[model samples]
Target: MIEVKGLSKRFGDIRAVRDVSFSVEKGEIFGFLGPNGVGKTTSIQMMCGLLTPDSGTIMIDGKELNPDSTEVRRKIGFVPQETALYPDLSATENLRFWGGLYGLKGDALNSRVEDVLRLVELTNRADDKIATYSGGMQKRVNLAAGVLHNPSLVFMDEPTAGVDPQGRFAILNIVRELAASGKAIIYTTHYMDEAQKLCDRIAIMDLGEILGMGSFEELRDQVGKGFQIFAKGDFDGPKLAHQLRKEYEGEVLHSGRGLLAVVVADATELGRFVAAMKAQGVNADDLKIKETDLETVFLKLTGRELRD
Candidate 1:
């Protein structure tokens, strides 16, 4: 339901978004995976018509998103990373205020407010001031305010950041429900597991360009049979890391925490490495044998850790 072509944005010498192009079909959850300064938010801003792109086009349901066009605003709901709500206003009151922006009034607006509040599981606190809510609760209210207009597309930026596991689960479930009901959702987050669970497809970005785009399995296959192994202990990191490189004939990465993280050629090599570690008197706890996840792909493409 959303199409972007050659989307580019620049600020002086720095190109924040560079020729990024992707499409989201109806009922799809497309993950815009990237680090903090990877232009995910900038791309979303252009797509939502919040900022005019230096070039390219954003088409939604076959209609272009014109910043001056009220029609585009009617069809999109944006829930940003920050909670954009009036602290003194009650949850219900906040929804009413936003819903009115989309021309929703009287019973229609009230019903949507109630429905979204219940969906976000903030019904009991609907009448309570937002200032009294926890971080997670405030996030739920923020989300409710976005969808009160029942827009066909929603842009959610870091929706689960800083929330507890229960709150995260609740928000993810609500996202799933929205996608199942045929709403195209553009979800942005640094959490690999969350993207894996929620996105039908993903676009990994860095330095104003799209490094890769595909399903998890597809991206993993790009790195071939290489798998990562992590073992935490008071081991000789550099020595063990060298041993891994020589033994498996693949790259080995060591962290400052005396943790050995290696990329081996195959799963068989992973098993052998574990056995060798045990034989060498290394405590095998914190052992993680994982195929290339989005995080690994991010690192491989960007030449840096996701946190960096």
Candidate 2:
């Protein structure tokens, strides 16, 4: 439903996004995963026509996106990272205002407001002022407003951030329902598990560029197969790390606090490493094998350095 190519943006001397490109399909959740300052927001803004890109083309439903085109802009719904609601307004009032902006009015607007309130499970608080609601409740209301017009495509940036687990779950279910109902969603979040669970395809971004793009398994395969062994017991962590590095050509990610996190190329090496550790008088109290997750793949592709 959407296509972006060679999307790049710059502010002054800083390039917030550079040659970043990806697409979202109908009824699919395309995850834009990255750390802070990785150009996720800038790219989204450009795609949503909220900001002009320095370079690249954006097409929605096969038509080239014109930021100034009201018809094109009306086809999208944006649920921003921050709540976009009036504190003094009731949830129903907020939805009415947003729907009116989308040219919704009278019975059509009222019907949509009711449907969205029910979709977000906020019907009970629809008449309550937004300021009086809890943070999670306010977030739900924000989500309701975004979908009030039932846009075919939605950009949900960190829709679940800072919400309670229940709220997060509800939001996730809503995303699934939206996709099932044939809405193409471009979802961005710092949460790896959410991306893994919801996204049909993911694009990992960093330093204003797309580092990797594919399904979870596809991205994991790019990082290669590996097993992380966590063992807790009495052991010379540094000494064992040195030995593993030499013998099996493995890397010790962590070594301290009566625990060792070792990465091995082959699973068979796990047993051998355990025996070797025992031979070195390191008695293992607990040993567990951890499969590589999205976070691991992200770190591998993006490096372990903290980003601002």
Candidate 3:
């Protein structure tokens, strides 16, 4: 339903997005995964016609996305990170207002508003003022407002940020329902678990460039076998680091006075690693092992952690 090629944008000397490209099918959830300030939102803005690209092309349903493409824009629904509803307005009022902006009216508009409210599981609180709702509830209504017109493709930019776990769970289900109904979804977030849970394919981006793109497992393979061992103690970092590089088929990811992290191919060698630490006479107050995750992938690709 959507295809982007060589998409790029710049703010003066800074390249906010560079040579980015990807595609999303009618029933697929395409994810833009990265940390903040990596241009995920800027790329989305260019695609949804909120911002013009400095270079490259954005095609939705075969036609180009430009200022004159009102019809193409109509096929998309964008739910931004922040709530766009009026504080004094109830959910029904908020959705009706947004629906009217889409030129929806009469029984058709009313039916759609009700349908989306039910879809987000907010029908019971449909009449509550947005100000009276929790962050999660407001988010659900924000989602309802975005798709009230039944757009063919939806752009959800961190729809679950700052929401409680239950709220996040509900929003995820709503997204699944949207995809099950055959609407293409472009979901952008830094949350690994959410992307892993929802997206069929993910594009990992950093410094305005796409470092990797594939399913979760596929991206994991790109980094080879990775299991991180983090130890915090007084130890000879360079000494142990040297030993790791020479003896193990992995990299000493982080090594310093108080912390040492190593990514090993096989986790079964955990005992020997612990033994080696003891042989070095290190006393670790905190030590932990992490299996390969999106954070690990992000670190391997960008040389920075996800929260960084």
Candidate 4:
């Protein structure tokens, strides 16, 4: 339902996005994963008509997107990272106000307010002031407001950020439901697990560029399959890490805290690893094997260095 091609944006000397391109299909949840300052937000703003790109084309539902076109804007919804609702207003009041922005009024507005409230499961507290609600409840109301106009596509920017586990789970379920109802969703988050759980396709972005894009298995293949060994107990963490690095020619991904994490290129080397550890006189009370996950793929593509 959405297509972006060669999208690039720059501010002064900084390039926030560079030649980024991707698409979102109907009834699909497309995940935009990246650390801070990776252009995820900038890219979303351009796609949603909030910002104009320096170069690129954006098409929604086969029509080229024109930021000045109200008809095009009416086809999309945006759920920003921060709460967009008024804390002083009740849940129903918030929805009503947002619905009115889309030119909804009277029965049309009231019906949509009720429908969205039910969708986000906020009907029970519809009359309660937003200030009285918990963080999770407020988030639900924020989500409801975004869909009040019943747009075909939605952009959710960190919808579950700062939410507790239970609340996160609830929002994840709602995201699935949104897709099931045939709404194309573009979801952005720093959380890998949430992307793994919800997105049908993912695009990994870094330094204003799209480093990789695909389903979980497809992207994993780019980095190749690997195995991680976590061992703990009476072992010299740094020394063991150094030894493993020398033997396998692999870097130690983690060390310290009485534990060591080593990444090997091949899973078949498991037997050799045990023998080598024993030969090193390393005694371990605990050992666990971890398969490559989304986190591994992300770190591999974006590097492990901290980003602002």
Candidate 5:
């Protein structure tokens, strides 16, 4: 229900986002992932009409969207990383206030408040002040406020950030239910496992660009369908890395710290790699094939491990 093309934004001398383009379909959860200061927030702000882009186009259900697309903004929901909630107010009170901002009023606002409190399983303590609630409970109330308008597309930035395990689980289930009901979602988080568990497709961004985008398998294949053998301790890491890079079909890198990684495509290639290492008089106390995961894919794409 949303499409963004060639989107870019700049601040003085720094360009926060550059030529970003992605789409979220109905009933799909699109994971917007990146390390800090990599344009994830800037991009989201433009899409939500909080910031205008310098170039490119944002389309909401086929119509062009802009900062003043008042009607279009009605179809969008934003769940910020920090809660815009009043601690003095109860959950029901907070929802009532925010729902009114979305043009919800009277019976419609009251009914939505009741429905969402139930949907997030917060009806039991809906009357308690938000300050008395746990962090998880507060987050649930924050979520309730965001979806009260029933927007067709939602942008959730680190919704599970800092929440306890139980709270995170509850929020994830709620996200699934929203998607199941045909709402498109743009979810951002530093947690790889959360992205793996919830997102239908993933986008990895770095340095204001999308380094990779696809399903887990598709992105993993970019690093080659392989095993990354990691070794530490005494060894000629740079020499071994150089030889492997020159002769092997996959990637090889020496971290300049005691670590060396060798990526081999399959069993036969792995065997040959092992033999080659032995032939080169390389011996290390630590050596084994590590499981290739989303981090591995990120490492291949960015030449560095993911760090928050």
Candidate 6:
């Protein structure tokens, strides 16, 4: 239930976000994905009423974003990219402070604190100081504070940034559980795998612009068949490639060694390519086709490596 239209933000002469627009449906996990410094945080800040955009509108449940409105803040939760938690306070104490800020008190506040702590699986450590918790634990606590108020919409910025693989999985599971509970989530990350697993739809941003937006399959189809076919080292390269191209109308590139890069419209061509290769005395079992995934789509669309 969040909508952004032509959202643009400028810092002096530089624009952090340029006419970027997208929407998040109620109870859906929408991903805001991009590389570093690509306006992800800037856009999120404006949506949370922490920063005002220079141009555009952010509407939440038909109510336009007003930076000073407590009513707006009441309906939204923000777990920032950075840790805004108190290192000295216990997990339960930290949540207590946050819950109180939202006008929660007495039994209502205490129940929320326990509910979110359990949701993040920090109940056993709820009384321990945050400094004793690992980075993942701290991030979980950070997430708990955001949702302690049970806001209808939550914005998570790099929620799993410093966590290990296990922690990342735990955090991802929590996000999924939240969506199942009917919370609309705006999740941001640089990890393609995370986005692939967590998002119902994704908006890929780069250089302050939305380069693409759609379901993962829709975006993957946009890149066509960038798949590759690899075979054993002794197989014929060019002659076999020529026959496969003639049969399937595919582009063949030698992928070094005996591996052949076959680009075609669909995987049905992959079967035909294998059959042709077998007819020419090559072992079909030695052939393997690698489907183009989201990482490949990102590299093609941004023309840059994810680490770069």
Task: Kindly indicate the candidate among 1 and 6 with the higher TM-score.
Answer: 1
Superposition TM-score, candidate 6 onto the true structure:
0.82
lDDT of 3 by residue, 1-308 (tens): 99999999999999999999888999899999999999999998998999999999999999999999989989999999999899899999999999998899999999998899999888999898999999999999999888999999999999998999999999999999999999999999999989988899999999899999999999888766668887777776667677655445457776666667778767776776787777655667888887877877776787766882
Task: Flag the better candidate by TM-score, 3 or 6.
Answer: 3
lDDT agreement of model 3 with the native: 0.87
lDDT of 1 by residue, 41-138 (tens): 99998888888999998999898889687887799999999999999999998999999989999999989998999899989989999999999899
Model 5 residue 244 CA deviation (Å) reads 6.2
Number of clashes recorded per candidate: 0, 0, 0, 0, 0, 0
Model 6 lDDT tens row, 180-292: 98999999999988998889999999888999999999988876756855555575566667666555666653433454555566656677777777677766436666677
Per-residue lDDT over 1-308 for candidate 4, one digit per residue giving the tens place of the 0 to 100 score: 99999999999999999999888999999999988889999999999999999999999998989867788888899999999889999999989899888899999999999998999898889999999999998888888888889899999999998899999988999889989999999999988888888999999999899998999889888656787776788777788877765555665666665677667777766677777788777777897766877776776676553232
State in Å the error of residue 178, model 4.
0.5
Q: Which regions in candidate 2 have their CA more than 4 angstroms from the true location?
A: 230-243, 251-262, 265-289, 305-308
What is the TM-score of each predicted model, taking all chains together? 0.87, 0.86, 0.93, 0.86, 0.88, 0.82
Per-residue lDDT over 1-308 for candidate 5, one digit per residue giving the tens place of the 0 to 100 score: 99999999999999899999888899999997778788888888889999989999999988788767889989998888887799999999999999999899999999999999998999999999999999888888888888999999999988888998989999999999989989999998878778878999999998888889998888877777767877776766676677655555556733545667767665456567666767777766776776677777887787776775
Q: Give me the candidate number with maximum TM-score.
A: 3
lDDT of 6: 0.85
Worst 10 residues of 1 by lDDT: 247-256
Candidate 3 Cα outliers beyond 4 Å, as residue runs: 232-239, 246-260, 281-285
Model-by-model lDDT, in order? Answer: 0.85, 0.86, 0.87, 0.86, 0.84, 0.85
In angstroms, how far off is 123's CA in candidate 5? 1.0
- For model 2, the local distance difference test gives 0.86
Per-residue lDDT of candidate 2, residues 225-304 (tens digit): 68877777877767777665645556675676576776777678788887777666677798877677677677677755
- C-alpha positional error of residue 69 in candidate 6 after TM-score superposition, expressed in Å: 1.4
Best by lDDT: 3
Q: Residue 151 of model 5: what lDDT? A: 93
lDDT of 3 at 288: 82
What 10-residue stretch in candidate 6 is worst by lDDT? 252-261
